[model samples]
Target: MTAATPPARVGPGRATWVWRRWGVALRFERRSVLVCGTLAAVVALLGVLALGTGSLRLSPAEVLSALFDPDADPRARLVVVTWRLPRLLFAVVCGAALAVSGAIFQSLTKNPLGSPDVIGFASGSYAGASVVMLLLGSADYLAVASGSLTGGTVTALLVYALAHRHGVRPFRLIIVGIAVGAFLSSLTSMLLLSVSPQQAMLVATWGAGSLNGLGFEQLRVAAVVLVVLLICAATVVRPLVQLEMGDDTAVALGVNARRARFAGTLVGVALTALVTAAVGPIAFVALAAPQIARRLTRGATTLRIAPAALTGAAVLVTADFIAQRVDLPVGVVTVCVGGVYLAWLLVRQYRGGRR
Candidate 1:
């Protein structure tokens, strides 16, 4: 009882420890929200800027008025509502779709390089679209979307089948993906070579990825697909988080690893297919966005998916803006910008390993 009086004293160390833990948790939540909010804001601002500063050059006020008032100048309203709005929406939707796809694939494979583009899914979709554009001379969104889904799903199934031996192995999956991607790419090249010059040119330009001339219909299709996939992604979020633990641990915690993987892969493939069909396989948004989000959030990997989607939207919209101003393709701008970031990531990984 006498010693209890002395024990009532609070040490500064204990208070400091509690403060630090709480501070860290608070900081993390705030940072995540901040990052996501910043991305969203940037995307919105870019959309406004893109609408105003295109070839026709409407003021921001004019663009806003045109957007809100149906009775605004028909020409300005048509440009904002019919033409540019669709492209802007496509940029946002496709960016988010590709980013989320990359996050899911990276989580499933437990590798940063396990994105659709790296793993042949993108190439497969490209192959499918190429066949439609080059062989059948059809740019119909439905045809392209169907072909892309078919090609990407086939590629993913093959990779999964090849990589599965009792259970999927990450390294084997990556290796198989690279091999499959190479084969598909070669097939695409062969098809391009076999096509007539006009068809080849058309396919090649689309392959390089341009948002030019995209109308409301394409944007609407992509938006519907993206929204559906996003809902699927939400359902699997808890399971995915558990699966990030070791297989045995995840199973013990009641996560059906196989089911989770299947669902995640299916959603991921669908998203990738939609983006590829809509915009011709814009690269690196999927790969880079999740990585950037993870670094920014500094949380467990699973939390990065939404933030990645936002960041991807921002990156793609910004890139599209630059592409339009410079008279270059969206794909070209993304590749150049993402290539630089990717190189930096590789170097950072190398340095971390050394440490």
Candidate 2:
């Protein structure tokens, strides 16, 4: 093991630490480390709280025992592991997935508000799932999941095509996404109106997004998919970070700006689609997590993927915990909470523009 080298750069109250060992160098900022670590701890604590506070109401110790000790009480193990654990894990994974997706889009567009929710990917996904539920009348998880992925992918392609005048510019992509999303929303509403009230209600309930009945089966597949998507996200991070500095600068630095944007967009949409497919369109996590993470880290770095992911996990776990107590869909909790945050964000942006 090599000794920790001194920070390469230092400022008034900031330093960038670089650790090199066996020909691999890792760069990190202290603030980013602290923020990511704190968020991870929060997520873990919230996960325990969530696992412990269900109908049976196990103590934290009981939850830990049930999780780790195979010889724990049968009932306790059944409740914590067989029942509540999947939902908790889903909240964490889905939240992280959504947040990372948001980070990618926001970085690509260089806009705070650029998220799958705002740009129509979520809407498209919901629309797709609604078609499976309403038209096909198939409530099978796999069928609906396929519809969602298809719908979101097609919508992204459409948006990309429309936005590609010379190249896929960020501003144009956002505008096109908004318009496409609106169209998809209206189409979904029309489908709902055309369908039986029972079908409409079913789709609506799923759209509300709860982690009520998810089990290890669903979690297993989603975890695998998220891992793959996140790895792809990692591959694009360096180029995306360079692109954040402006296309000309990125080009000067030997980064492929257009390719990076396209790859980032693909990965971001896939992440959103993964979550939407698993639990329906849980709104605001994708929109709020990255921004919240960025602020919590005080903009320590341009690409705050890890912090955003951890922040997202914490936010979703916390919201799911609240939802479990209140018997409401987790999406409802997020919307109510995220709506206020969105309003404040809009006001702040407006004021900033005026200044």
Candidate 3:
């Protein structure tokens, strides 16, 4: 009797790599591996450039030496390791988190526009952080992080409850998220109005989402938290992907659609909130990264988590690099670029619908 092949196989024609160990198996698409690797390399190269380019301008060699060689110049080490490394790490880590959040939401909603920024979660987090900043007058990391997380969690629950009717609908979720986000934004603005100019300015600059002045302390905590959240994300990702094949199909395949969606939503919210807490709300990485990955890979895979994340890291690092040259906040550059990308997406969808 012949043994049946595992379900993970994508059939005979596609290029796939499979690994088996301890009676377990893992399957990966070759193209995805290549693309993700290339994107990772791009991110690393960008990081090196970002670390190297500054007022003191070190070469790539100097950046590497300062990073690795203990005997390297103290000034070079201070500039690369002390001053620039944290910011670059923040960009990469936060960008990946946002992109993963975006991928999760977009998959759940089956809509390109289903991002945290579009669906009210980012606004909720910002509002939460703003509350801490203005009302509590606490600029402390832990306080702001707590407030942001609470706000985002509340917002997610609110959106989920509002969108639920028989079951949660993607279209309804998007509409409700937008409405809630707008309301929360208005409330945030009111809070800003109530604050003193100095306080308001602090909140405003934070809201603009700059990675300036962040250091090892913030990065260490944020990185550890993000890693934990990402591990949670990975656990839910397979079931989440199954759920994408429609709830009925997913259920038949032994997946609980509602449970998967719920868990995925929580992970996505946490990811966004963590970044918002650390660096404020960064726009468009979540929205654009997955779509960009899809196009770049020519829609070769339904699972987009890895590629989207890598693309996000590269995109944010590149944007931050540009931001440094222009002496602007990273958020401002993403807004300008992502605004254009969003407009283009809208027009494309409109044209497709008309046809």
Output the TM-score of candidate 1.
0.88
lDDT of 3 at 74: 98
Q: Give the TM-score of candidate 3.
A: 0.94
Instruction: Report clash pairs, candidate 2.
Output: none
Extract clashing residue pairs from model 3: none
lDDT of 1 by residue, 1-355 (tens): 1111111223332111111342242112556667788888889888999998776999888999899987899999988998899889989988999899999998888888788988888998898888888777789899998899889988999999988898888879988998999999999999989978888888889889888888986777778778888988888877877888888999999888889998998888889989888879898898898888888776668336679889889889999999989989999999999888778877986898899
Tell me, by lDDT, which candidate is best: 3
Q: Model 2: per-residue lDDT, tens digit, 222-303?
A: 9999899889999999898888888889999999876887788788888887888788889888888888888887884436
Q: What is the TM-score of each candidate against the true structure?
A: 0.88, 0.93, 0.94
lDDT of each: 0.84, 0.86, 0.90
**Model 3 bad stretches (over 4 Å):** 1-9, 21-23, 299-303
Best by TM-score: 3
Worst 10 residues of 2 by lDDT: 296-305
Q: What C-alpha lDDT does candidate 3 achieve relative to the native structure?
A: 0.90
Give me the displacement of residue 106 in model 1, in angstroms.
1.0
How many clashes show up per model?
0, 0, 0
